[model samples]
Target: MLVLFLLGTSSSALAKGQKHTYWHLTSDAGEEAGKEFESQLRSVLVQAEGTHHTTEGSLAELLDQKPLKVPSCFEGAKLCTTVPELLVEALGVDGLVEGRISAAADGYQVELTLYREFGGTPKVVTRSGADLEGVVRDAVGALFTLEAAIKIYTEPAGASVFVNGNLVGESPTRVQVHEGNHGLRLEKEGYEVLREDLTVLPGEVREYNATLVPKVTQITVITWAESAAVYVDGKLSGASGAPIDVMPGAHSLELRANGYRPIEITFDIAAAQRRTIQLAMLKEVEDPWARREQAIRTYRLYVEAGYALTLQSIGFAGATADIAGSTYSPTSFGGEDRASLVFNGVKLAVGYTMERLGLVFLGVDLMVASMDSELILTAQDTARRESAVGQGASHIALYPLQGTFRELWGAFGAEAQTGLGVSFDSLNGDLTGDAFDLSQTAVFWSLAASGRYYLSEEWSLTLGYRMDYDFADQRGLRHGFFAGVGFNLPLLVDAGGESKDESLPEQLEEDVPVEGTDVPESTLQKLEQSGTEGGREP
Candidate 1:
């Protein structure tokens, strides 16, 4: 019976050609019972597929030992003894099976341990029953045949799979695992890890389909302005300080806010990386009209001192004169005289300007003129008088309407102004050894056209031609050419007030936009090109 049983077991083992060894089975029941249990386990293992079984007696014979005394410490539930480094090589088997049998209250307790040649944690199974053979058979079957198949399929295949922290095959692949609890982990480049705990029963086939998520590059944009809108890859993402998720690649980022310059940049991101971008928006320059309006409304003081050459025509009325020994009545003596005089004057003005509206100037002008020439009193009288005359005038000057037509070069501009005021004029001199004293108060008006060359922000050279008419007893019409230096001092005032400086024409030329003004088309195209290139809304 023993020979026939060995032949029956060895027939399948020889055909399979895989080598597994029954190391030993020990028991406190007795040596005879231990031998019988070991023989039964060896016969059962040899009959099973996948591995040929080698008995401990045959393995000991190969080692030239009468009997093998495997250590008792190696037979316990815990691995209390160190395994030999060359134990598998010395045993000359693909795997080893070892067990311990102890007396239980029912009958016997069996513990089986399976160790493979490719070293790993050994699998152990424990069972107790009154039937010793049944208990041994069941424990061996649990250790050898109780396996589950897990078929792992990943969305993007080729992820490395780990079972119980040990690297298994890549998905989508099949792994044979011992029937129990298992920790499954899948890892792929640019994809999130998938981890799961699974419990499988004996001979169970589990289909585990895992959809691996791609790892995102976390992009955090922190902007100086909270109202700034953020964009990634030309898509509006969110506002400042919001986090964006993107694939690991090169991307374009942009930030835009009203009244601030827009920012754009490109950067590359890595997988599973966190990147932070900090930005500060630059404020755009105010509109030209806005700056012009602000500057126009600021209060200013103007002071100008100038020299004027004037040709004055004086009408003489109600004058008493003797003609050829005949006394002429005062009412009948009416004539005109002309004089060329040089005048030095100073003018002080305060004013303000409004856009689209005009400007106002309230000023005081003081002038003194001196003349040394022979003046004929009249053509009818035929009298030539060598006269030394001094004249002085003080005028309250007001200019209510002013307009600037254009700017000539960058530094030069022109304006036309008209004004009316009240003047006090005095003349006191010796006329051919006679006292000639006259005082006249009159209402005067003047029209002026001036050209300015700006020297600085507050200073300019002014040349102007003015015509003045006086309504008084001695009606005079004067044509004057004046040259002067003008100074403008801006008073720091809020925008609510209306104020203007004498330099407003220059300001308008540089800052303010006028209607019907011709701007170069290329300049406008450049401005539009820059705005479009920024990729931001106005």
Candidate 2:
């Protein structure tokens, strides 16, 4: 903190022999926080009427970039640098000031010090709040955050509260406590419940914002009067006197009243989601009706099934891993070396998309390949074994291993997709034909840009460009254009049933002429059925 002020030795104070002043100050720049010493002194001497005893000092980091407000995202730790003692001596003043910061509740504070000229005891200054600007008006934790403290609040207020697994407070005079993250819960009898993660910084006041998510329930033993106890994820959310508001996502809810058959349902909650569930109290069925209803639910799900579609692509490639050994064969692959090895195509796909959070999606990939190659191996002292096998002859071995690293290996991020969703993509792949199939395949990877325009719900137009190493027949960059029809596979989604989208062929039925005339039906059949034959409209 840097303040420009002017002060003079008070004659009345001097006469009374009480002239030691307690002063506080503030600075606008983070790097020059210590610059306050000289700045304040200069302001007092040049800007104010000061004459008796004067002191000036600086803070720790004189040239560090200010810490960004984005918390841990953009830190200012790098901007901090130390100044030499000579420079501090050059601006000889009464004292130097220094301090460090730690979070409290809603804000942060710093413990400052006033250094003496003779290296005497330092003056300790403590600011206690988020609003503390300086010691002049003044009066002041390295905390690594962990579990965050979530705030809990009622729309109106005065709701009973609970924290971590226990009952804590009631609304209105709700106690705001702790500086850090924590599990929180808030509830009210007969109201929806709230529970969430909370992260509060030291010296910061946090809110555990809980709102009731309404749900249409089937807890009624009887139509309009029965009240079921609402449990969120197997725990009591408020006493379910009415539909309670709960945050959306996956949750297990049980509605049990004494006389009513206990009913439990699981569902996913979304943001700002409002659900009105009417508990349809059902009468105790004999046997057949209950079985019939269960059967209907299962049958209906089968009828509403959607279609399946697959995206396809084809490619030819080759490559060579050149060994730097003295006695090794330098082989090449691609269009130059014509052989039985051909890469029909490679495909990656995801299927069975539902309205869920990618729960139903299953990713798959296929590679169509046939290749033959001979490798020079040092088996005998003077003679090398040339192992040549037929194309598509090698058996593929499957080894699936999952490994976790302390650091992240891959990530998807883009500045353009910060808020809105439109973005760009790139990908590459490389393969070695045999040992050295350079003439056929060289590029191990390729990059492609694709733009899609959906003209209608049933169809879309796609355009793409790829800049890649020539692996097919060792060709440089072979550009290609493609246009294809996109249709839903309604048959695939059905349980091996006839596709509704495909109608019966009309050409299957044929007309025959009678022997005596050109009529389509016989005289006997004409009496039994309609005699005239149908003709195409011209």
Candidate 3:
């Protein structure tokens, strides 16, 4: 026998102990056959357990001899739709069970229908078998099978519900589960999974409500620098070295700190996950004063060695020159007896430039020179005598306004200097055979104009002319021209640290450290000072 049960309504009505009246079981085989099947089925129902069975005879008696009319639809049809309504109105039964039997090729096919008093669509159980009584027995047993009704609700209404590891449906839904122990699981995205063990009894309508917790991901950022701002998805979250909470997914993170390179990253996180990101930020150079201090060469040490040519003259006031024991009054004594001297000397200077004020330098200068000259004395008798003289001077030169010209061809400058010096003059080898020597030390003041050309940051070439007038003992005038190669040693001021080539704005914008890193303390202090000073200025 092949018996199949199809339930059209919830099986809760079929639970044990329900009251139902047994209606007629019709058949097309014959009236005698129908009567025999109905009698056997009624006998079986009366013996059944867990239910109250009322027969058609008892229902008619309850109505006081009223004639019972079976609906015409049950005569040969597969279903009887009007039976539950009639039974409920006449006998006031809770439910009604009706069936129809038809001849099949094998033997017989039976369709059993159950309807509740509320007039819903009926439940049908079908069976086909050669043994008519056995089919009726099996159909009755199938009709009243036990099941538990489960109503599942979740905080998020659309979570998938699984019963005994099988997907049932989404909650807030109702499902008919077979009576027993079962594992129930609910799952939703971004929420924790919920699982519980359930033991349901027959006819139990169990309501389950689950409040699911959300899945959170924690991100810890460990930066090499302090006070780094941490940003997630373009919104500022907090400082680095702190934990940030976020939903699990792809995100953009940015780390920014003063004086350090900014860093950006894109990453994905998993649910209930902990992630740590360790970052080292690069340094940035953003202080303009520091850069200017480095770029400005503040100290200059100069050593110059040069060759000089000088003209020395002594004026005569009513003076007479003795030539070969003869006395003569000479009119142009200063012009005719002028001595030209060549000297080799060196000049050394130490200077400090006020770069912030505008490339002006204040310095002390020293010049030392040794000069030897041949003085020629001539007479009207066509006699010429020569005397050799030696001269030396040590002078200190000072410039009131000395500065570099930046816009000219490659580093050039001009300065005017006035200085005082002691000049030593010696005359030896007189025109006569007798040797004579005369020495004089005199104080002299000099005026000079010099031009300098820089060969590099620390080297130069200088050329100048100077005039000197002696003021004590021997009143004499000297004019000199000099040419020299200069070596300039620069003493650069410390701008807190080594200078960088990046511009200040660029460094401030992009070059900074991310995490646990640090800029030099000296550099940072200088930068802050520079900023403070700049703010104070116009």
Off by over 4 Å in 2: 1-23, 26-111, 114-151, 165-168, 172-174, 214-538
Instruction: Write one digit per residue (lDDT tens) for candidate 2, span 309-341.
Output: 212121223232233332322222232333333
Candidate 3: which stretches are off by over 4 Å? 1-188, 191-216, 223-227, 231-236, 246-248, 252-265, 280-350, 354-362, 376-396, 405-538
What is the full ranking by TM-score, best candidate first? 1, 3, 2
Task: Write model 1 residue lDDT over 1-538, tens digit each, in one string.
Answer: 0111121234223334555544445677777667666676654453244553443234333344314544554332222336732355444456555677777888878887777776888788998988765676578777666456788999889999999999988999988877789999999988898899999765556899988888877888764455588888999887876778887889888888765567788888888988777654444554444544454334555566665555554433433344344332222111224333455576544544332223445655667766444433332354333223333322333433333232344456575666676765554444446545444566677777778776754676888897878776556776677777877667566557433333212211121111122334443343344342222234
Q: Provide the lowest-lDDT 10-residue window in model 1.
A: 507-516
Clashes of each: 2, 62, 13
- Every candidate's lDDT: 0.58, 0.34, 0.58
What are the RMSDs of all candidates, in order?
A: 20.8, 35.5, 19.4
lDDT of 3 by residue, 2-119 (tens): 1112222222244445554545456777776676676656544543433544333343344443356645543332223434566555445566666778888888788878776777
Ranking by lDDT: 3, 1, 2
